[model samples]
Target: MSRYDWNDERHALGVATMDATHREFLELARAIESGPPAEFATRFEGLVEHTRAHFAAEEALMRETACPSLREHEADHARVLGDLGRFLQSVAKGRPAMARAYIASGLSEWFDLHVATMDAQLAAHLNARQHAG
Candidate 1:
């Protein structure tokens, strides 16, 4: 099982701002695993909240660019959030072990998938939008 870390370059988007944000997301995930309980709670909330915001930003970019995969990208975002909700809800009940496991595995897996396919396409679309604008 791969432990989550920013060094895993698969998380990178080759877009500095987006890559930085992804790094921050990984930092939060790492902190949740290694920090104090209260700190972890804070980071976890940030993780969930930032995820929503990030998805919104990406979706907007997709729509603006008329990305062919816009619907599929949005679908993937929803599915990721649904999984995150399950993780957070479980954590809310004091199931840190389950939450951590989900974070370590599911989160990483989803991110890999998102970055490689969904986000990559969105980023390319956004780049095109930038030039076209």
Candidate 2:
């Protein structure tokens, strides 16, 4: 199985929208990892675009809820977005080797850690707010 495959126990945060977005992210990552070489650039671009939307949605939620970790979370999103943009540039230039390596390992590792930490915190905060409301 691809490292990008979603494991609910590991990846699901119990926040409906966030969990769904995360599932989509993993699906896109898995597709890029296993897709044909000719399709790599396009698939990678799709992942980047999806990720931009995903991060924006989460950031908006953070803003709405006044999440204490908003700044740190936003910084993490920015860093990942910057990396994705750089990788997209290389892919566009027909130099996909580095980007492929990143997708295969770096990105997957980051996703696991990010979901467990920052996303989990956000999910907990949201859940608490929901229950207390």
Candidate 3:
């Protein structure tokens, strides 16, 4: 299986929305990585767009729920978004080599860690809040 394939044991956090979004992210990344060369730029653009919306939704959740890690999580999201923006620029310019490598490896590795740590914490906090309420 491709590195971008979603593994429920590894990626699922028991939060329905978050889990679904993460699953979609993996699917999109996999598509971009495996799509035809001619479609690489277009697919990558779609991933970038999806990521923006995904991060925004998570940040919204953090805000509405008063998540303790809001600042740190927002910073992480900003960092990734900045990187994606730069990569998208390159891809748009017909220079996709570096971006392709990043999508193939860097993104997958980052996603795994981010989900296990940041997202896991958020999911737990959300669950606790729900139960407490």
Query: Could you tell me which 10 consecutive residues in candidate 2 have the lowest summed lDDT?
Result: 31-40
TM-score of 2: 0.98
Number of the predicted model whose lDDT against the real structure is largest: 2
Of candidates 2 and 1, the better by lDDT: 2
* Alpha-carbon deviation at 10 in model 1, angstroms: 2.2
lDDT of each: 0.77, 0.95, 0.93
Q: Candidate 3, after superposition: displacement of residue 124 in Å? A: 0.5
Tell me which of candidates 1 and 3 scores higher on lDDT: 3
Clashing pairs in 2: none
lDDT (0-100) at residue 10 of candidate 2? 91
For model 3, residues 1-133, the per-residue Cα lDDT tens digits are: 8998889889989999999999999999998877899989989999999999999999999999999999999999999999999999998888999899998799999999999999999999999999999
TM-score of each: 0.83, 0.98, 0.98
| Regions of candidate 2 where Cα sits further than 4 Å from its true position | none
Q: 103, model 1: CA deviation in Å?
A: 1.2
Candidate order (lDDT): 2, 3, 1
Measured over all alpha carbons after superposition, the RMSD of each candidate to the real structure, in angstroms, is: 2.5, 0.6, 0.6
Error of model 1, residue 114, in angstroms: 1.4
Better structure of 1 and 3 per TM-score: 3
